[model samples]
Every structure is written in C-alpha cells, then in structure tokens.
Target: MGLYLPDAIRLHARERGTRAALSCADRTLGYAELHSRTNRLARALLTAARPGSRIGFLARTRTEAGEILIAAAKAGLVTVPLNWRLSEAELTALAQDAGLRVLLTEPEFRSAADAVHAALPGLRLVIIDSPAEQQDRQEQPDPPDSPDPSGPAQAADPAVPGYEAWLAAHPDDDPGRGGRADADEVYLQIYTSGTTGVPKGVLLTHTNFHAERAELEESRWQPGSVALNALPLFHIGGLGLLQMALSAGAHSLLLPDFTPEAAARTIEREGVTHTFLVPSVLHLLTELPGIERRDFSRLHLVSYGAAPITPALLRRSLSVLGCRFQGKYGLTEAGGTVTRLAPEDHRPGGPRSHLLGSVGRPRPGVRVVICDPGTGDPVPPGTVGEIRIASAHNTPGYWNRPQETTELYDARGLLCTGDGGYVDEDGYLFLTDRVKDMIVSGGENVYPTEVESALAEHPAVFEVAVVGVPDDLWGEAVTAVVVPRRDLPRPGEQELIDFVRQRIASYKKPRRVHFVGELPRNPAGKVLKRELRARLRQSHQ
Candidate 1:
C-alpha cells in the first residue's frame, strides 16, 4: 500500500503502466508519462522550493493541474490552487497570507497574475503559456467587432519565464532525492469562500485524502472506468475527484470549468461511465440544448452535493440520465466527503424514499453527531444542532492560525461543522440551515431553508434565497429574494407569504419578496447569503 500520495502515482505507473490516466481537451497522459513528468517537474521545483514553502496555481483545470499537484506532493512542497474568480486584491491577500514563493499563471488570467506578481515582487511568477505562445497571442490580429479569439486584446507584455522551458531544464530521471515529503505533512491548502469573513486557508495533510476514498472504493465505478470532472480544480470536489479516479487507476477527463453543453458532449464523446456534479450543474444539464438527444446511458453513478437538490430536480435527473443517483455531503475541512446517500438510498417512491433528503449515514470509519454549538454537547436524534465530526481524514486546521485552529476543534477531537442539521433515528443526516445563515426575529429562530423550500414549491418560483432584514417592530423581518421562472409570471409578496404561512409557521413567512434576474453563487453553487445580508445592511443605512 502507498504510504504517501506520490506513492499512489508511482504505484499506478509501475502496476498500470501504459494505461491512460488523464485527459484534458485533446491531450491524454498515461500513468508512466504522468509519473515521469511529475518527477521532472518536482526536480525542477526542488531547485528553488523548500519544504513548507507555498507554490500556487492560477490556471484552469488542465493536464498541468495534476502534474503540478503530484510533483508538489512528491517534493514536500505545499500547493495552493487559487480561485480564478476572485478580484486581484483578494488574490493578493491570499497569496500574501500563504507566504507563497512561486505562482503558475495561465494565459486567460494573465492580467490578474501580472497584478498579483506586481503586488508581491518577491514572489516568483512562472507563466504556464510559453514565450512563443505569448508572442503568438500578440501577433494575432483583432477583429473589428468581437473580442480577440487568441486572448486579451491589450498590448503585449514583455515575455516572462515559460513553464515548458522551466520543466525542460531539469532531467527526466527521478532525482531519487525527491523534494521534501512526509505522510503527515500538509500537502495542499484550499481557502474558504470568505462569505462570513476573510477566507482562511485550510491545511490538508497526505492522510486527509482517505475520507472520500473510503466511500469511493465501495462505489460501483469499475477500475479503468472513464469519468469526467467539470468542477473547478481549486475546490475540494475537483481535486478529490481526480484523486478518487486515480485510486482505481480509472481514466479521467477534466474540464476547465463546467458548462452544460461541454459536459454533455464530453460524456457522449468519451463514453464516460461515471461523473459527479453539484445540484446546480445537474439542473443546467437538464436544461441543455438537445439534451434529449444526449447519450447519458453510459453513466452508471451520478453523485451530487455542495448544495441541496429539490425532489423535483432529482426526479428530473433520474428521468433524464437513467442512472443511479447518489447524494453526498461534505465540507473542504473534512478533506473531501464524510458521508453520502448511496444509490440505493435514492429510491424515488420506495419504502426508504424519505432518505432522499438525508445526506445518508456516515461511511465506515467515520463518526458524526448533532451537537450544541456553545456547549459541544451532543443533541438527541431528530433535534437540529451543529453537526460535529470526528475523523482521521479531517484537516489539521487553518494554515498558520493556531488560535483559530484551537477554537475550531473541541476537547473530544471533534470539530464543529458550523452547519446546523439533525440526524434521524437511523443515523441519516438532514441539513436544516447554516449557523451563520439562521435568522432571529422577535426571539424566534428562523431557518431560511424552510421558507425557501416552501416558496420553491410555487410553480412560478425558480430560485429563492431567504434572509433577515432589520425591522423597527420585529427586530428582524424575514425577506425572500427570488428569481421567477421564465415560463411563468412572478408571484406576489403576499401570495407567496401566504403560501409559506399555509405550509409552515406564520412567523417564518417572508415579510417582503424581491424578484431578481439571478442569484449570486460561488464556484460550488452555494448561494452567497452573506452578500445578501450585506446588501440589506447597505440599503437600511
């Protein structure tokens, strides 16, 4: 068995040599080649990077994504995958916080990379696109009307260091003096969304990779099965998906980002048999053009999480894809996945139909509890409380923040998940609301999910987010931000409020309903309730 992550790649190369391992666009890398390339890159990186020094990547999901991460793991360097969607200032703050020594840049994010590099002059910036690619980009003529196809239309920036040249300088032989490495060392760092506050970096050790593996090994996906992953590589889902596929030596395809059309086409083209997605992505897949003609028959298991899925959407997915559905629940802090509703748990109308809404019982070697947030006492089953988790797969904690780390974990070695939810009598977990997202009105606690679920039942409602706004009399008034279904007329505030009152308690109904063109979401399809609360404060001010 592999002791560290890099050992897995080495094991695959020796045992599954010449087997196809990864695909991105038109390029595919075999396990042996992938192993060799990672070694070469690791040797080159060793020339500069020291143990614990952070190396960052600001590129989309591509072939280089795996190579960089694998090499970093082997060399004992910490890798930070930057969120390309963040502003230059936000990216700068994260890079500074990580004390980064190197950053790999992609052409699409050249401007942002340049800014980040300028802000941190001491940080080494290595452009993933070569010097010639940069020149070719400059030489391409811009059309009068459309944006430049090659890249940004701005004037050419001076040629900087190229990734290809950097890697080529080192020998392909395994410099047996591998970069620094250890089984317990922090191998990866992923930052939080910073919805509640500044994003903090989460440190994941080599052992942390086992959380999701425990469940994935039991999945129906076969060895060498073809799989496609469209989640952003920066997120835990994306990186963990790659590791999961590699665990079984499965053939993997990665996309730069998710698009319903690309995902459908890739599944059909690659004959992909397994894939995982967020609920939002699944909804978009259902809405794709020519979706009726798309061949999803090859898909064996379809897993989704990172956000809730309504029964309506789940029904649509089952009808459209004709595949077994798995509902998953996890957080970045938990490594990848802590629990999942098995495919059998998704029976639409079977005896255990109610389990569809639950994230499912914890997998083997995992422990979970619904506990009081303040006292850390486990609550009885069926009572909502902060979900606490104890697992060897859990991350060590935030990078370089000892105080924050100490506060995150309790004396029992269990960490409060910050998500408020309950466990059923059968040990199934049902999500209620986020602790920070809970609203208090006239001393009554209101979870937005209950109201949102009620409003979502309306035929005209498409997407909805519930928040609490300041009210002179009620202290905090329940407000619903809604996106109306395009095919129907918008529902009125009183009508929807009455709609909720009839379903749940009257106090939980929205006092006001605001229709929106769309809702703001992060990479993982999670609604930004923090942003909505900030908007309410600004309006009242």
Candidate 2:
C-alpha cells in the first residue's frame, strides 16, 4: 500500500490530469492519457505474461518506452531495459541470463530482436511500428499533433503483435492489487554496463525507488518543471531521472537519440529547466559550432554523473550554459545517486574551488564509509579505501546470483563499492580510482584517475585514459592513451609524460603515451580501461 511508481502517476493524474507527463519530438501525453494508457497497457501485459515475470524492452528513449515502464510496474512485472548499443551476441547473452520470455521492441531494432528471438524461440515479440507504416496502413497523412498516442502505427506482421493495436484492445480498468504488488516487490532489474567485468543484473524494489523522493526536494523539482533526457533508457541515470520527474508530477522530455545539434535545439525550443548529461556529452555540447548562439535561459540545473568530468570541460560548460551544475557519484547497485556536488561547490576560483574535484557529501539518510581493502576496517579521513554505502536506496542484491550477492555486502550489511576513494575531513568524497584499476609500479601504488586528472590539464590533450602495462623493471607500468585536441599542436610522448610529472608524483606519471583519435568507452561514458590494458599489453608482446 506504499507509494509505488504507478501509484505516484495515478495521483498526478487526479490532481493535474491535463498537464504534460511525457514528451518526445512532437508527441506529448498528459497525465490523464498516460494513466489510462498505462492501465490498458498493464492489462495487455498481464494477458501476455504473468505477474512477477520479466519483461524486456529493447529500444531507445521515447514516450512509448516510458509507457511500458509504468505499465510493467502496475502489472507487477519486472522491467528489464536492454541496451540497444550492445552487439547481437551480447544481447543474446543478457536475454538468456535474464530468461526473458517476452520482449517489446521498435522497428529500428526489429532485425536485432528477431535475432534474439531466433536464439530463444520461446521469446514473444511485440513491435512498435514506424510512422511510414502507420501512414501506409491508414492510406492518409498523419496529423501534426496526433502522432499515434500509444506509439507508432501497426506494421503488417502476423508473427508479432503490433504494440499500438495490442494496447488499444485491452480494457483500461486499474489492475490494482490483483497483481499482488507491494512496496517490497522487485520492480526493476538493471544490468551493470560491465565496465569492470561481465554484466550482472541489479534487482531494485519499490522501497528502493521510494527513497529517491528525498532527493526531489534537494533538486528543487516543481510541477511545471520540464526535464530533457538524452541518455539511453537502459542506463540507470536515464531511468532514475525519469522516475524522479514523474514522482514530482513534472514533465519529462525523452530524446530518442543524442546528437549535439538536436539536444541544443530541443533545450531552446522546449524550455528545458533541468537535465542530466554525462561529461562526454557536455563536452560535445560546449564544442558544438555556434554554441554561443543557442538560448539556454530556461535551464536551471544540469546534473551530471556516470563518470567524472574534467576540470577544463566543466569550466567551459559553466561559462557556455550559464546554469547551475551538480555532480553525482553512484553505482547501479546503489539504486542511482548517493552524493551530490552542488552548484555552490562547482566554482573554479572560489574559496572552495578544491571541492570541485570531490563528489560532495552523502545525500539524506545515506551513510558513506571508507573501508580498508585488506582488513575490512574503517579508514581514517583522507585515507584511500573501498567506498561502502548504507542507505535505503541500496538494492537487495543481484538477480539469480546469490554467491556474488553474498560477496557484495560486508559483515555490517553495507554495500561494498569496488571503487577506491576517501572521505575528506569536511565529509566530501574524493574518488581516486577503481580498486581493480589501481596499479603497483615498482612497489608504489598509483591511481590512474589521479594520473589522468593531471594529464587533462594539458592544453594539447582532449581526452585521456590511464592504464597499467607490464614492464621488466616495474611489475606494472603506468601508460596513457590520449586523444589530442584537433586545434592544438600535439605534444611529444616525453612532453606529455613530463606534463603529468609536474602535477603529481613522478612515479605516477605515464611511462609511455599513445596518441589515439579517440578512446574506447562504454555507453555510460566510462573509459574501458580493461580493454585498453589488454590491447596495450598485446602491442608490447
């Protein structure tokens, strides 16, 4: 009987039925329509799969994607958002691991969906058709404002059900408690992006999501606020942000695909008041041609997370966007965000300028403790250790992986984050490096992030990732892969290495520098250091 995602939307529908609940491109759904549509969609889903079943969604950000998410919650089904950027083999692996029996996909990924279905023939497919197909079905031009409220129109297919027609045929009655939903029910299962290892499903419940309500007040989300989200729905940041906006009865604008030009235009036209973008995207937006001409007056806050932002990129973004900026640090297992670096702490030259590098204090009701890696004991302030979190936002554990789940939590029931960091005397959290990414070069511990931060200050370096490589003298050598700025003259290997030497300890400096056009990254914008380590080691051989 606690506040679940569907329950929150139902309340919004009663209080502000005519207000826009979701938008993408020219399509918008008011709270009333969204409520009714999700109800019907929930019933539709119930007919296809039983309550507590895992439902897979393989597509980008769109209004229909949001519809399915809410509908799944109402129907007491667990929603598993699949990253479309992954390869077919990768998708097949995840589908198999999750044991998906039902999948909702769009025309853009129809072939990929078919491939997965072929692998697991038991999986049923529901396709979100294209506008052209809808136009062909009706033999008339579609209206400007009316762009298929449910989704795109029906495509001619006998094997798979059309999402729009399938949804419309179901009754709009509330599914209610018949689905056996409760606050403790597992509602979402998001897979880790596999930055460090193979992906594992993180199971989150209604209680975990409800904990985010505390953050809405801190974010200053109002009923009239409009948030533009360009991050893929499969990502935790994208889904969590949408939930926070909807929980506050605010409108969420989903950008199906992210292009620098498209996002800029959307913000200007839609008057987006809040948004969340990764550092890489922020860099792209600030570097876009004629970026100064765009109007961002309505933008009140830009919350960035998933990866750390370089000082140069952050400063440029502040000057160009002219809005408050907040930084967050969290993992998928922690249910989204745990800490925030507020706008007041983002100043480049202010008294607290040093705080710009910290991830700020823990959010309300969240406790962060740095623990010794070897002894599992609490570390003193400013001493680097594995980050541990205790909060209602923490997920129960991974799905179907009890062994790993058991290992995830410590004796104190705290989720042990594998990232290496320390809490400063002022309670601000500073990330040094991933525990697995830390290198021991000639008996000295070197954190790659500390080395990378130093190289980022170089004018010639556009982007850089530090990794460890094998050496004869040093058990592991620190190496740097750099993306040089197109406009600036590229520096020599020795010069770049020396540049980092001036900022940090000489031993932490990169022994070798490889200039690349771009560094490999996951969808979440985290550098694939493991991949770099493998490729670099192979080159040395």
Least accurate 10 contiguous residues by lDDT in model 1:
150-159
| TM-score for all models, in order of appearance | 0.91, 0.94
C-alpha lDDT values of all predictions:
0.81, 0.87
Give the per-residue lDDT digits (tens) of candidate 2, residues 372-476.
Answer: 988889999999999999998899999999999999999999899998999999999999888988999999999987888889899888888899999999999
Best by lDDT: 2
Candidate 2 lDDT score relative to the true structure: 0.87
Candidate 2 lDDT at 207 equals 75
* TM-score, structure 2 vs. true: 0.94
Q: Candidate 1, residue 252: CA error in Å?
A: 1.8
Instruction: Write candidate 1's Cα lDDT for 105-210 as tens digits.
Output: 7878889877777777777777786445655765787536535555432333323556776777787766442222465788899998776688899999887763
